[model samples]
Target: MIEMTKRIRDLEVSEHLRTLTHERFGTRGRFTLLERASGIGASKWKNFYYKKQEATTEMIAFWIEKYPEDESFLMTGKIPPRKDGYPFGTIPPHVRQTETISDRLNWVIVEWTSPRGAALFEYLEERSKHQIAAEEWKKTVLGEQAPTAAMVEIVCKARPYFAAWITCGSEIDSYDQVDPTCTRSIKTWRSNLLKQLMSAPSEDPEK
Candidate 1:
Protein backbone atom coordinates (compact mmCIF):
# COMPACT_ATOMS: atom_id res chain seq x y z
CA MET A 1 0.00 0.00 0.00
CA ILE A 2 2.84 2.38 0.86
CA GLU A 3 4.64 1.61 -2.45
CA MET A 4 1.41 2.21 -4.41
CA THR A 5 0.90 5.57 -2.64
CA LYS A 6 4.47 6.57 -3.41
CA ARG A 7 3.95 5.65 -7.10
CA ILE A 8 0.81 7.78 -7.28
CA ARG A 9 2.56 10.77 -5.66
CA ASP A 10 5.52 10.47 -8.03
CA LEU A 11 3.16 10.30 -11.03
CA GLU A 12 1.42 13.50 -9.89
CA VAL A 13 4.71 15.32 -9.42
CA SER A 14 5.93 14.19 -12.85
CA GLU A 15 2.74 15.43 -14.47
CA HIS A 16 3.05 18.78 -12.70
CA LEU A 17 6.65 19.19 -13.88
CA ARG A 18 5.70 18.36 -17.46
CA THR A 19 2.88 20.91 -17.36
CA LEU A 20 5.21 23.58 -15.96
CA THR A 21 7.81 22.86 -18.64
CA HIS A 22 5.25 23.04 -21.42
CA GLU A 23 3.81 26.28 -20.10
CA ARG A 24 7.27 27.81 -19.86
CA PHE A 25 8.11 26.90 -23.45
CA GLY A 26 5.04 26.99 -25.66
CA THR A 27 3.87 24.06 -27.82
CA ARG A 28 6.95 24.33 -30.07
CA GLY A 29 9.44 24.24 -27.19
CA ARG A 30 12.44 21.98 -27.85
CA PHE A 31 14.54 19.83 -25.54
CA THR A 32 17.69 21.64 -26.67
CA LEU A 33 16.41 24.86 -25.08
CA LEU A 34 15.87 23.01 -21.80
CA GLU A 35 19.29 21.43 -22.11
CA ARG A 36 20.85 24.89 -22.43
CA ALA A 37 18.81 26.46 -19.63
CA SER A 38 19.03 23.66 -17.06
CA GLY A 39 22.43 22.23 -17.96
CA ILE A 40 20.72 18.86 -18.21
CA GLY A 41 21.29 16.79 -21.32
CA ALA A 42 18.42 16.13 -23.72
CA SER A 43 18.50 12.38 -23.07
CA LYS A 44 18.05 12.80 -19.32
CA TRP A 45 15.25 15.37 -19.80
CA LYS A 46 13.52 13.03 -22.19
CA ASN A 47 13.84 10.17 -19.75
CA PHE A 48 12.27 12.25 -16.96
CA TYR A 49 9.37 13.38 -19.15
CA TYR A 50 8.74 9.80 -20.29
CA LYS A 51 8.89 8.66 -16.64
CA LYS A 52 11.76 6.32 -17.47
CA GLN A 53 13.67 8.06 -14.68
CA GLU A 54 12.73 10.40 -11.84
CA ALA A 55 13.94 14.02 -11.67
CA THR A 56 16.82 14.21 -9.20
CA THR A 57 17.23 16.91 -6.52
CA GLU A 58 20.11 18.45 -8.42
CA MET A 59 18.05 18.68 -11.60
CA ILE A 60 15.10 20.27 -9.78
CA ALA A 61 17.44 22.74 -8.09
CA PHE A 62 18.88 23.77 -11.42
CA TRP A 63 15.40 24.31 -12.89
CA ILE A 64 14.33 26.40 -9.89
CA GLU A 65 17.43 28.56 -10.06
CA LYS A 66 17.00 29.08 -13.77
CA TYR A 67 13.34 30.05 -13.34
CA PRO A 68 13.16 31.54 -9.85
CA GLU A 69 9.73 33.08 -10.48
CA ASP A 70 8.34 29.63 -11.27
CA GLU A 71 9.82 27.97 -8.18
CA SER A 72 6.63 28.22 -6.12
CA PHE A 73 4.48 26.56 -8.81
CA LEU A 74 7.22 24.08 -9.69
CA MET A 75 7.38 22.88 -6.11
CA THR A 76 3.72 22.99 -5.08
CA GLY A 77 1.72 23.48 -8.31
CA LYS A 78 0.41 26.83 -6.94
CA ILE A 79 -0.26 29.71 -9.31
CA PRO A 80 2.24 32.54 -9.00
CA PRO A 81 1.46 36.29 -9.04
CA ARG A 82 0.90 37.83 -12.48
CA LYS A 83 3.61 40.18 -13.69
CA ASP A 84 3.16 43.06 -16.17
CA GLY A 85 -0.22 41.64 -17.30
CA TYR A 86 1.33 38.25 -18.10
CA PRO A 87 1.35 35.04 -16.11
CA PHE A 88 4.58 33.61 -14.83
CA GLY A 89 6.43 31.34 -17.30
CA THR A 90 4.04 32.14 -20.17
CA ILE A 91 5.54 33.24 -23.48
CA PRO A 92 4.88 36.84 -24.49
CA PRO A 93 2.36 37.59 -27.26
CA HIS A 94 4.90 39.30 -29.54
CA VAL A 95 7.32 36.39 -29.26
CA ARG A 96 4.53 33.93 -30.10
CA GLN A 97 3.57 36.07 -33.12
CA THR A 98 7.18 36.06 -34.35
CA GLU A 99 7.35 32.29 -33.98
CA THR A 100 4.12 31.91 -35.96
CA ILE A 101 5.55 33.94 -38.85
CA SER A 102 8.74 31.87 -38.80
CA ASP A 103 6.65 28.68 -38.83
CA ARG A 104 4.72 29.86 -41.91
CA LEU A 105 7.91 30.81 -43.72
CA ASN A 106 9.52 27.46 -42.89
CA TRP A 107 6.43 25.54 -44.02
CA VAL A 108 6.44 27.33 -47.36
CA ILE A 109 10.18 26.77 -47.96
CA VAL A 110 10.52 23.28 -46.52
CA GLU A 111 7.23 21.38 -46.25
CA TRP A 112 4.98 22.59 -49.07
CA THR A 113 5.27 20.75 -52.43
CA SER A 114 2.77 21.27 -55.22
CA PRO A 115 2.02 20.47 -58.87
CA ARG A 116 1.72 24.24 -59.37
CA GLY A 117 5.45 24.45 -58.70
CA ALA A 118 6.15 21.90 -61.44
CA ALA A 119 3.92 23.82 -63.84
CA LEU A 120 5.77 27.04 -63.03
CA PHE A 121 9.06 25.30 -63.92
CA GLU A 122 7.67 24.14 -67.26
CA TYR A 123 6.45 27.63 -68.06
CA LEU A 124 9.89 29.09 -67.21
CA GLU A 125 11.69 26.68 -69.53
CA GLU A 126 9.35 27.35 -72.45
CA ARG A 127 9.50 31.14 -72.04
CA SER A 128 13.31 31.23 -71.71
CA LYS A 129 13.68 29.00 -74.82
CA HIS A 130 16.34 27.16 -72.81
CA GLN A 131 15.91 23.62 -71.56
CA ILE A 132 16.05 23.62 -67.77
CA ALA A 133 16.32 19.98 -66.76
CA ALA A 134 13.65 18.58 -64.37
CA GLU A 135 16.17 17.84 -61.60
CA GLU A 136 17.39 21.47 -61.62
CA TRP A 137 13.87 22.90 -61.30
CA LYS A 138 13.13 20.44 -58.48
CA LYS A 139 16.03 21.85 -56.48
CA THR A 140 14.79 25.45 -56.91
CA VAL A 141 11.19 24.74 -55.85
CA LEU A 142 12.37 22.61 -52.89
CA GLY A 143 14.42 25.66 -51.71
CA GLU A 144 17.62 23.62 -51.91
CA GLN A 145 18.86 26.91 -53.39
CA ALA A 146 17.39 30.21 -54.59
CA PRO A 147 16.18 30.67 -58.14
CA THR A 148 18.15 33.20 -60.22
CA ALA A 149 16.86 36.77 -60.50
CA ALA A 150 16.76 36.47 -64.32
CA MET A 151 14.61 33.36 -64.04
CA VAL A 152 12.27 35.09 -61.57
CA GLU A 153 11.86 38.13 -63.86
CA ILE A 154 11.22 35.94 -66.90
CA VAL A 155 8.63 33.85 -65.09
CA CYS A 156 6.92 36.95 -63.70
CA LYS A 157 6.59 38.36 -67.20
CA ALA A 158 5.57 35.09 -68.93
CA ARG A 159 2.99 33.77 -66.45
CA PRO A 160 1.86 36.67 -64.27
CA TYR A 161 -0.95 34.56 -62.79
CA PHE A 162 1.34 31.73 -61.63
CA ALA A 163 4.14 34.09 -60.68
CA ALA A 164 1.77 36.28 -58.68
CA TRP A 165 0.74 33.28 -56.63
CA ILE A 166 4.33 32.04 -56.38
CA THR A 167 6.03 35.37 -55.72
CA CYS A 168 3.41 37.67 -54.14
CA GLY A 169 1.44 35.09 -52.06
CA SER A 170 -1.81 36.05 -53.83
CA GLU A 171 -3.10 36.95 -57.29
CA ILE A 172 -1.66 40.30 -58.36
CA ASP A 173 -4.81 42.12 -59.51
CA SER A 174 -2.84 44.90 -61.22
CA TYR A 175 0.61 44.34 -62.69
CA ASP A 176 0.73 48.10 -63.39
CA GLN A 177 0.97 48.73 -59.63
CA VAL A 178 3.89 46.34 -59.11
CA ASP A 179 7.03 48.29 -58.26
CA PRO A 180 9.94 47.59 -60.59
CA THR A 181 12.49 47.94 -57.77
CA CYS A 182 14.64 44.86 -57.06
CA THR A 183 13.91 44.90 -53.31
CA ARG A 184 10.13 45.08 -53.80
CA SER A 185 10.31 42.27 -56.37
CA ILE A 186 12.15 39.95 -54.00
CA LYS A 187 9.72 40.74 -51.17
CA THR A 188 6.79 40.02 -53.48
CA TRP A 189 8.30 36.69 -54.45
CA ARG A 190 8.77 35.60 -50.84
CA SER A 191 5.34 36.91 -49.78
CA ASN A 192 3.66 35.07 -52.66
CA LEU A 193 5.52 31.89 -51.78
CA LEU A 194 4.04 32.03 -48.25
CA LYS A 195 0.57 32.84 -49.67
CA GLN A 196 0.71 29.91 -52.09
CA LEU A 197 1.75 27.66 -49.22
CA MET A 198 -1.35 28.67 -47.23
CA SER A 199 -3.66 27.78 -50.15
CA ALA A 200 -2.13 24.35 -50.84
CA PRO A 201 -4.10 21.29 -49.70
CA SER A 202 -2.61 19.93 -46.48
CA GLU A 203 -4.02 16.38 -46.64
CA ASP A 204 -1.40 13.96 -47.96
CA PRO A 205 -2.74 12.42 -51.20
CA GLU A 206 -0.81 9.21 -50.55
CA LYS A 207 -2.52 8.78 -47.21
Candidate 2:
Protein backbone atom coordinates (compact mmCIF):
# COMPACT_ATOMS: atom_id res chain seq x y z
CA MET A 1 0.00 0.00 0.00
CA ILE A 2 1.11 3.55 -0.66
CA GLU A 3 1.79 5.49 2.49
CA MET A 4 0.58 9.09 2.26
CA THR A 5 2.34 11.75 4.29
CA LYS A 6 1.02 15.03 5.72
CA ARG A 7 4.36 16.71 5.36
CA ILE A 8 3.10 19.49 3.13
CA ARG A 9 6.17 21.31 1.88
CA ASP A 10 6.10 24.96 2.73
CA LEU A 11 5.33 26.68 -0.60
CA GLU A 12 8.07 28.73 -2.23
CA VAL A 13 8.08 32.51 -2.86
CA SER A 14 9.54 35.04 -5.34
CA GLU A 15 9.10 38.74 -6.01
CA HIS A 16 7.74 38.69 -9.55
CA LEU A 17 5.05 36.09 -8.91
CA ARG A 18 4.46 37.58 -5.47
CA THR A 19 3.12 40.73 -7.08
CA LEU A 20 1.09 38.73 -9.58
CA THR A 21 -0.50 36.30 -7.11
CA HIS A 22 -1.42 39.08 -4.74
CA GLU A 23 -3.10 40.68 -7.74
CA ARG A 24 -4.85 37.43 -8.67
CA PHE A 25 -6.52 36.38 -5.40
CA GLY A 26 -6.67 39.84 -3.91
CA THR A 27 -5.51 38.11 -0.74
CA ARG A 28 -2.37 37.24 1.22
CA GLY A 29 -3.09 33.57 2.12
CA ARG A 30 -0.83 32.18 -0.63
CA PHE A 31 -1.11 28.54 -1.71
CA THR A 32 -2.06 27.25 1.73
CA LEU A 33 -5.36 29.02 1.37
CA LEU A 34 -5.35 29.25 -2.43
CA GLU A 35 -5.15 25.46 -2.61
CA ARG A 36 -8.21 25.18 -0.43
CA ALA A 37 -9.99 27.92 -2.35
CA SER A 38 -9.17 26.49 -5.75
CA GLY A 39 -9.90 22.89 -4.65
CA ILE A 40 -6.74 21.77 -6.40
CA GLY A 41 -4.85 19.07 -4.40
CA ALA A 42 -1.13 18.69 -3.70
CA SER A 43 -0.52 16.56 -6.77
CA LYS A 44 -1.99 19.25 -9.02
CA TRP A 45 -0.55 22.03 -6.88
CA LYS A 46 3.01 21.21 -7.92
CA ASN A 47 2.39 22.82 -11.29
CA PHE A 48 2.56 26.15 -9.48
CA TYR A 49 5.26 25.29 -6.98
CA TYR A 50 9.06 25.23 -6.85
CA LYS A 51 11.73 27.30 -8.54
CA LYS A 52 15.34 28.29 -7.83
CA GLN A 53 15.14 31.68 -9.49
CA GLU A 54 11.45 32.71 -9.69
CA ALA A 55 8.26 32.00 -7.77
CA THR A 56 4.94 31.35 -9.55
CA THR A 57 2.30 34.07 -9.43
CA GLU A 58 -0.16 31.60 -7.92
CA MET A 59 2.31 30.69 -5.19
CA ILE A 60 3.11 34.30 -4.50
CA ALA A 61 -0.55 35.10 -3.97
CA PHE A 62 -0.83 32.16 -1.61
CA TRP A 63 2.26 33.27 0.32
CA ILE A 64 1.10 36.81 0.93
CA GLU A 65 -2.15 35.66 2.45
CA LYS A 66 -0.35 33.14 4.64
CA TYR A 67 2.19 35.61 5.94
CA PRO A 68 1.73 37.26 9.33
CA GLU A 69 1.33 40.73 7.87
CA ASP A 70 -1.53 39.53 5.67
CA GLU A 71 -4.16 41.71 7.31
CA SER A 72 -2.11 44.81 6.87
CA PHE A 73 -1.79 44.23 3.15
CA LEU A 74 -5.43 43.25 2.88
CA MET A 75 -6.52 46.33 4.74
CA THR A 76 -4.43 48.59 2.58
CA GLY A 77 -5.42 47.49 -0.93
CA LYS A 78 -7.41 45.10 -3.04
CA ILE A 79 -5.92 42.97 -5.77
CA PRO A 80 -7.93 42.98 -8.94
CA PRO A 81 -8.60 40.11 -11.28
CA ARG A 82 -6.07 40.11 -14.10
CA LYS A 83 -6.94 42.67 -16.75
CA ASP A 84 -7.67 39.71 -19.01
CA GLY A 85 -10.31 38.71 -16.51
CA TYR A 86 -10.33 35.24 -14.96
CA PRO A 87 -13.57 33.19 -14.57
CA PHE A 88 -15.47 35.83 -16.54
CA GLY A 89 -13.68 36.73 -19.80
CA THR A 90 -12.13 35.76 -23.07
CA ILE A 91 -8.56 35.82 -24.34
CA PRO A 92 -7.93 38.89 -26.46
CA PRO A 93 -7.34 38.53 -30.21
CA HIS A 94 -7.59 35.16 -31.93
CA VAL A 95 -6.33 32.67 -34.56
CA ARG A 96 -8.95 29.95 -34.32
CA GLN A 97 -11.96 32.16 -34.63
CA THR A 98 -14.45 29.36 -34.00
CA GLU A 99 -12.76 28.04 -30.83
CA THR A 100 -13.27 29.17 -27.25
CA ILE A 101 -11.92 28.29 -23.79
CA SER A 102 -15.36 27.01 -22.84
CA ASP A 103 -15.14 24.83 -25.91
CA ARG A 104 -11.71 23.52 -24.88
CA LEU A 105 -12.53 22.66 -21.27
CA ASN A 106 -15.29 20.16 -21.99
CA TRP A 107 -15.50 16.41 -22.69
CA VAL A 108 -14.37 15.47 -26.19
CA ILE A 109 -12.98 12.51 -28.12
CA VAL A 110 -11.68 11.93 -31.63
CA GLU A 111 -11.12 8.80 -33.72
CA TRP A 112 -8.29 8.15 -36.13
CA THR A 113 -8.76 5.56 -38.86
CA SER A 114 -5.09 4.73 -39.29
CA PRO A 115 -3.58 4.43 -35.85
CA ARG A 116 -0.13 4.19 -37.35
CA GLY A 117 -0.35 7.15 -39.70
CA ALA A 118 -2.46 9.61 -37.72
CA ALA A 119 -1.39 12.02 -35.03
CA LEU A 120 -3.85 11.65 -32.19
CA PHE A 121 -3.50 15.08 -30.65
CA GLU A 122 -4.48 16.39 -27.22
CA TYR A 123 -3.76 19.82 -25.76
CA LEU A 124 -4.89 22.66 -23.51
CA GLU A 125 -5.58 25.47 -25.98
CA GLU A 126 -5.23 28.84 -24.28
CA ARG A 127 -5.55 32.33 -25.75
CA SER A 128 -3.15 34.94 -24.44
CA LYS A 129 -1.52 38.29 -25.26
CA HIS A 130 0.46 40.74 -23.20
CA GLN A 131 -1.76 43.31 -21.52
CA ILE A 132 0.51 46.26 -22.28
CA ALA A 133 1.16 46.06 -26.02
CA ALA A 134 -0.20 42.89 -27.58
CA GLU A 135 -3.67 43.20 -29.04
CA GLU A 136 -4.18 39.64 -30.22
CA TRP A 137 -4.49 36.28 -28.45
CA LYS A 138 -2.70 33.13 -29.55
CA LYS A 139 -3.25 29.40 -29.06
CA THR A 140 -0.66 27.66 -26.92
CA VAL A 141 -0.04 24.17 -25.55
CA LEU A 142 -0.92 23.43 -21.94
CA GLY A 143 0.82 20.06 -21.43
CA GLU A 144 2.41 17.68 -23.87
CA GLN A 145 0.42 16.79 -26.96
CA ALA A 146 -0.46 13.10 -26.97
CA PRO A 147 1.43 11.56 -29.90
CA THR A 148 -0.55 8.36 -30.35
CA ALA A 149 -3.96 6.88 -29.68
CA ALA A 150 -2.62 4.95 -26.70
CA MET A 151 -0.91 8.10 -25.45
CA VAL A 152 -4.17 9.94 -25.90
CA GLU A 153 -5.89 7.34 -23.76
CA ILE A 154 -3.20 7.63 -21.13
CA VAL A 155 -3.52 11.39 -21.29
CA CYS A 156 -7.29 11.16 -20.96
CA LYS A 157 -6.78 8.94 -17.96
CA ALA A 158 -4.55 11.63 -16.47
CA ARG A 159 -7.49 14.07 -16.61
CA PRO A 160 -5.34 16.86 -17.90
CA TYR A 161 -6.73 20.15 -19.18
CA PHE A 162 -6.40 18.84 -22.69
CA ALA A 163 -8.29 17.98 -25.86
CA ALA A 164 -7.70 15.77 -28.88
CA TRP A 165 -6.53 18.12 -31.61
CA ILE A 166 -6.24 15.79 -34.58
CA THR A 167 -7.42 12.28 -35.34
CA CYS A 168 -5.52 12.57 -38.61
CA GLY A 169 -4.67 15.28 -41.11
CA SER A 170 -8.30 15.08 -42.19
CA GLU A 171 -9.84 15.73 -38.77
CA ILE A 172 -9.00 17.71 -35.65
CA ASP A 173 -11.14 17.00 -32.62
CA SER A 174 -10.78 19.13 -29.50
CA TYR A 175 -12.47 19.70 -26.15
CA ASP A 176 -11.62 20.22 -22.46
CA GLN A 177 -11.95 17.63 -19.67
CA VAL A 178 -14.30 19.06 -17.11
CA ASP A 179 -14.10 18.53 -13.32
CA PRO A 180 -10.42 17.76 -12.64
CA THR A 181 -11.13 16.04 -9.31
CA CYS A 182 -9.97 12.55 -10.24
CA THR A 183 -6.29 12.20 -10.95
CA ARG A 184 -6.35 8.40 -10.54
CA SER A 185 -5.56 7.58 -14.16
CA ILE A 186 -2.76 10.08 -14.67
CA LYS A 187 -1.41 10.87 -11.20
CA THR A 188 2.00 9.32 -11.73
CA TRP A 189 2.31 10.80 -15.19
CA ARG A 190 1.40 14.26 -13.87
CA SER A 191 4.28 14.05 -11.41
CA ASN A 192 6.69 12.92 -14.07
CA LEU A 193 5.42 15.28 -16.75
CA LEU A 194 4.88 18.53 -14.85
CA LYS A 195 8.22 19.78 -13.50
CA GLN A 196 6.95 22.43 -11.07
CA LEU A 197 7.51 25.19 -13.58
CA MET A 198 6.14 28.71 -13.56
CA SER A 199 2.73 29.41 -15.16
CA ALA A 200 0.66 32.58 -15.46
CA PRO A 201 -2.80 31.03 -16.16
CA SER A 202 -3.39 34.35 -17.87
CA GLU A 203 -4.45 32.92 -21.18
CA ASP A 204 -8.09 32.24 -21.66
CA PRO A 205 -9.10 29.05 -23.41
CA GLU A 206 -12.33 30.74 -24.46
CA LYS A 207 -11.09 33.34 -26.83
Candidate 3:
Protein backbone atom coordinates (compact mmCIF):
# COMPACT_ATOMS: atom_id res chain seq x y z
CA MET A 1 0.00 0.00 0.00
CA ILE A 2 2.81 2.42 0.89
CA GLU A 3 4.61 1.65 -2.40
CA MET A 4 1.30 2.09 -4.28
CA THR A 5 0.77 5.50 -2.65
CA LYS A 6 4.32 6.54 -3.56
CA ARG A 7 3.79 5.47 -7.17
CA ILE A 8 0.59 7.52 -7.37
CA ARG A 9 2.30 10.58 -5.93
CA ASP A 10 5.20 10.18 -8.39
CA LEU A 11 2.80 9.92 -11.28
CA GLU A 12 1.03 13.10 -10.16
CA VAL A 13 4.33 14.99 -9.87
CA SER A 14 5.41 13.70 -13.32
CA GLU A 15 2.14 14.84 -14.90
CA HIS A 16 2.43 18.28 -13.30
CA LEU A 17 5.98 18.70 -14.54
CA ARG A 18 4.97 17.58 -18.05
CA THR A 19 2.05 20.06 -18.09
CA LEU A 20 4.30 22.89 -16.89
CA THR A 21 6.91 22.06 -19.53
CA HIS A 22 4.24 22.01 -22.26
CA GLU A 23 2.81 25.32 -21.08
CA ARG A 24 6.25 26.92 -21.06
CA PHE A 25 7.85 25.45 -24.19
CA GLY A 26 4.83 24.21 -26.21
CA THR A 27 6.90 21.32 -27.68
CA ARG A 28 9.08 18.44 -26.53
CA GLY A 29 11.77 19.69 -28.94
CA ARG A 30 12.53 22.50 -26.49
CA PHE A 31 13.31 20.16 -23.59
CA THR A 32 17.04 20.73 -24.07
CA LEU A 33 16.51 24.47 -24.18
CA LEU A 34 14.56 24.29 -20.90
CA GLU A 35 17.33 22.15 -19.40
CA ARG A 36 19.86 24.83 -20.41
CA ALA A 37 17.67 27.63 -19.03
CA SER A 38 17.12 25.76 -15.76
CA GLY A 39 20.82 24.95 -15.41
CA ILE A 40 19.85 21.35 -14.59
CA GLY A 41 21.56 18.64 -16.64
CA ALA A 42 19.65 17.02 -19.52
CA SER A 43 19.63 13.56 -17.88
CA LYS A 44 18.33 14.95 -14.55
CA TRP A 45 15.59 16.92 -16.33
CA LYS A 46 14.55 13.82 -18.27
CA ASN A 47 14.56 11.77 -15.07
CA PHE A 48 12.30 14.30 -13.40
CA TYR A 49 9.77 14.14 -16.26
CA TYR A 50 9.92 10.34 -16.44
CA LYS A 51 9.42 10.04 -12.64
CA LYS A 52 12.61 7.95 -12.46
CA GLN A 53 13.88 10.47 -9.85
CA GLU A 54 11.94 12.70 -7.47
CA ALA A 55 12.34 16.46 -7.73
CA THR A 56 13.52 18.16 -4.56
CA THR A 57 12.25 21.39 -3.01
CA GLU A 58 15.64 22.94 -3.82
CA MET A 59 15.16 22.10 -7.49
CA ILE A 60 11.64 23.64 -7.42
CA ALA A 61 12.92 26.76 -5.68
CA PHE A 62 15.62 27.18 -8.32
CA TRP A 63 13.04 26.99 -11.11
CA ILE A 64 10.69 29.40 -9.32
CA GLU A 65 13.49 31.89 -8.75
CA LYS A 66 14.43 31.68 -12.41
CA TYR A 67 10.81 32.30 -13.37
CA PRO A 68 9.40 34.47 -10.57
CA GLU A 69 6.09 35.08 -12.39
CA ASP A 70 5.42 31.34 -12.39
CA GLU A 71 6.19 30.81 -8.70
CA SER A 72 2.51 30.60 -7.69
CA PHE A 73 1.66 28.07 -10.36
CA LEU A 74 4.80 26.05 -9.80
CA MET A 75 4.37 25.94 -6.06
CA THR A 76 0.58 25.70 -5.75
CA GLY A 77 -0.49 24.26 -9.11
CA LYS A 78 -2.85 27.17 -9.69
CA ILE A 79 -2.99 30.02 -12.18
CA PRO A 80 -1.11 33.11 -10.98
CA PRO A 81 -2.93 36.35 -10.46
CA ARG A 82 -3.01 38.57 -13.55
CA LYS A 83 -2.34 42.30 -13.55
CA ASP A 84 -4.45 45.03 -15.23
CA GLY A 85 -3.54 44.06 -18.80
CA TYR A 86 -0.66 41.64 -18.37
CA PRO A 87 -1.42 37.89 -18.34
CA PHE A 88 1.05 37.13 -15.57
CA GLY A 89 1.19 38.47 -12.02
CA THR A 90 2.21 42.10 -11.73
CA ILE A 91 2.48 44.26 -8.64
CA PRO A 92 -0.94 45.59 -7.66
CA PRO A 93 -1.48 49.37 -7.82
CA HIS A 94 -2.26 49.67 -4.12
CA VAL A 95 0.94 47.77 -3.33
CA ARG A 96 2.89 50.22 -5.51
CA GLN A 97 1.24 53.17 -3.73
CA THR A 98 2.02 51.66 -0.32
CA GLU A 99 5.68 51.23 -1.31
CA THR A 100 5.83 54.83 -2.55
CA ILE A 101 4.38 56.09 0.73
CA SER A 102 6.84 53.95 2.71
CA ASP A 103 9.77 55.37 0.69
CA ARG A 104 8.59 58.96 1.23
CA LEU A 105 8.17 58.35 4.96
CA ASN A 106 11.70 56.99 5.17
CA TRP A 107 12.97 60.12 3.37
CA VAL A 108 11.06 62.35 5.80
CA ILE A 109 12.55 60.50 8.78
CA VAL A 110 16.08 60.99 7.45
CA GLU A 111 15.93 64.45 5.81
CA TRP A 112 13.45 66.54 7.83
CA THR A 113 13.03 67.11 11.55
CA SER A 114 9.63 68.62 10.94
CA PRO A 115 7.59 70.47 8.31
CA ARG A 116 9.49 73.56 9.41
CA GLY A 117 8.13 76.39 7.26
CA ALA A 118 4.69 75.09 6.28
CA ALA A 119 1.42 76.58 7.59
CA LEU A 120 0.64 73.26 9.38
CA PHE A 121 4.18 73.27 10.80
CA GLU A 122 2.90 73.63 14.36
CA TYR A 123 0.49 70.70 13.91
CA LEU A 124 3.29 68.54 12.54
CA GLU A 125 5.49 69.46 15.50
CA GLU A 126 2.76 68.49 17.95
CA ARG A 127 1.88 65.29 16.05
CA SER A 128 5.45 64.04 15.62
CA LYS A 129 5.95 63.22 19.29
CA HIS A 130 2.43 61.83 19.50
CA GLN A 131 3.08 59.57 16.52
CA ILE A 132 6.20 58.18 18.16
CA ALA A 133 4.37 57.64 21.44
CA ALA A 134 1.45 55.96 19.68
CA GLU A 135 3.74 53.54 17.87
CA GLU A 136 5.54 52.67 21.09
CA TRP A 137 2.23 52.15 22.87
CA LYS A 138 1.04 49.92 20.06
CA LYS A 139 4.20 47.83 20.33
CA THR A 140 3.61 47.37 24.04
CA VAL A 141 -0.02 46.36 23.48
CA LEU A 142 0.56 43.95 20.59
CA GLY A 143 3.53 42.31 22.41
CA GLU A 144 4.79 41.26 18.98
CA GLN A 145 7.30 43.80 17.67
CA ALA A 146 6.30 43.71 14.01
CA PRO A 147 4.03 46.39 12.60
CA THR A 148 0.56 45.09 11.66
CA ALA A 149 -1.84 46.09 8.88
CA ALA A 150 -3.53 48.62 11.16
CA MET A 151 -0.16 50.25 11.80
CA VAL A 152 0.49 50.41 8.05
CA GLU A 153 -2.94 51.97 7.49
CA ILE A 154 -2.11 54.73 9.96
CA VAL A 155 0.95 55.60 7.90
CA CYS A 156 -0.91 55.15 4.60
CA LYS A 157 -3.55 57.63 5.70
CA ALA A 158 -0.87 60.24 6.47
CA ARG A 159 1.02 59.83 3.17
CA PRO A 160 -1.05 62.11 0.94
CA TYR A 161 -0.75 65.07 3.30
CA PHE A 162 2.99 64.46 3.67
CA ALA A 163 3.39 64.31 -0.13
CA ALA A 164 1.37 67.51 -0.63
CA TRP A 165 3.38 69.35 2.02
CA ILE A 166 6.73 68.14 0.67
CA THR A 167 5.98 68.77 -2.99
CA CYS A 168 3.68 71.83 -3.09
CA GLY A 169 4.11 73.47 0.33
CA SER A 170 0.45 72.71 1.02
CA GLU A 171 -0.93 73.48 4.49
CA ILE A 172 -2.95 70.33 5.19
CA ASP A 173 -3.30 69.98 8.96
CA SER A 174 -4.56 66.36 8.90
CA TYR A 175 -5.78 63.61 6.55
CA ASP A 176 -9.39 64.18 7.55
CA GLN A 177 -9.23 67.92 6.82
CA VAL A 178 -8.15 67.45 3.17
CA ASP A 179 -11.59 67.24 1.37
CA PRO A 180 -14.42 64.82 0.68
CA THR A 181 -12.50 63.46 -2.31
CA CYS A 182 -9.35 63.03 -0.25
CA THR A 183 -11.36 61.33 2.52
CA ARG A 184 -12.71 58.84 -0.03
CA SER A 185 -9.17 58.26 -1.26
CA ILE A 186 -7.94 57.48 2.24
CA LYS A 187 -10.85 55.06 2.79
CA THR A 188 -10.08 53.38 -0.52
CA TRP A 189 -6.43 53.01 0.46
CA ARG A 190 -7.37 51.44 3.77
CA SER A 191 -9.92 49.20 2.02
CA ASN A 192 -7.27 47.98 -0.41
CA LEU A 193 -4.95 47.14 2.47
CA LEU A 194 -7.73 45.19 4.17
CA LYS A 195 -8.56 43.37 0.95
CA GLN A 196 -4.93 42.40 0.37
CA LEU A 197 -4.56 41.06 3.89
CA MET A 198 -7.77 39.11 3.55
CA SER A 199 -6.98 37.70 0.11
CA ALA A 200 -3.41 36.65 0.83
CA PRO A 201 -2.73 33.05 -0.29
CA SER A 202 -3.05 30.49 2.47
CA GLU A 203 -0.22 28.08 3.15
CA ASP A 204 -2.52 25.27 4.21
CA PRO A 205 -3.98 23.46 1.19
CA GLU A 206 -7.16 22.60 3.12
CA LYS A 207 -7.89 26.31 3.42
Q: Which candidate is the best by lDDT?
A: 1
* Per-residue C-alpha lDDT of model 1 across residues 80-198, encoded as one tens digit per residue: 55434221123222221223322222223221222233453454466567656544554554335556655556555544433433354432444332222233543565566667789
> Model 1, residue 198: what's the lDDT?
98
Pull out the clashing pairs in model 3. none
RMSD for all candidates, in order, please: 15.5, 21.0, 20.4
Model 3 segments more than 4 A misplaced: 1-14, 84-207
* Local error of candidate 3 at residue 124 (angstroms): 59
Report how far off residue 45 is in candidate 3 (Å). 1.0
Please report how far candidate 2 places residue 146 from its true position, in Å: 25
Candidate 2 residues 1-207, lDDT tens each? Answer: 123221111222233344544443333333443455444554344344334334334544554544323323333344333332122122211223214432233222211111110111112111111221111111111112223333334434543444332221112222232212223323433443344333435668899
Top candidate by TM-score: 1
**Which runs of model 2 end up more than 4 angstroms from their true locations?**
1-13, 28-31, 37-207
Q: Write the per-residue lDDT of candidate 3 for residues 45-122, one digit (tens) a residue.
A: 677766677775655766665445455566557765543332112222222122333333333322333321221223
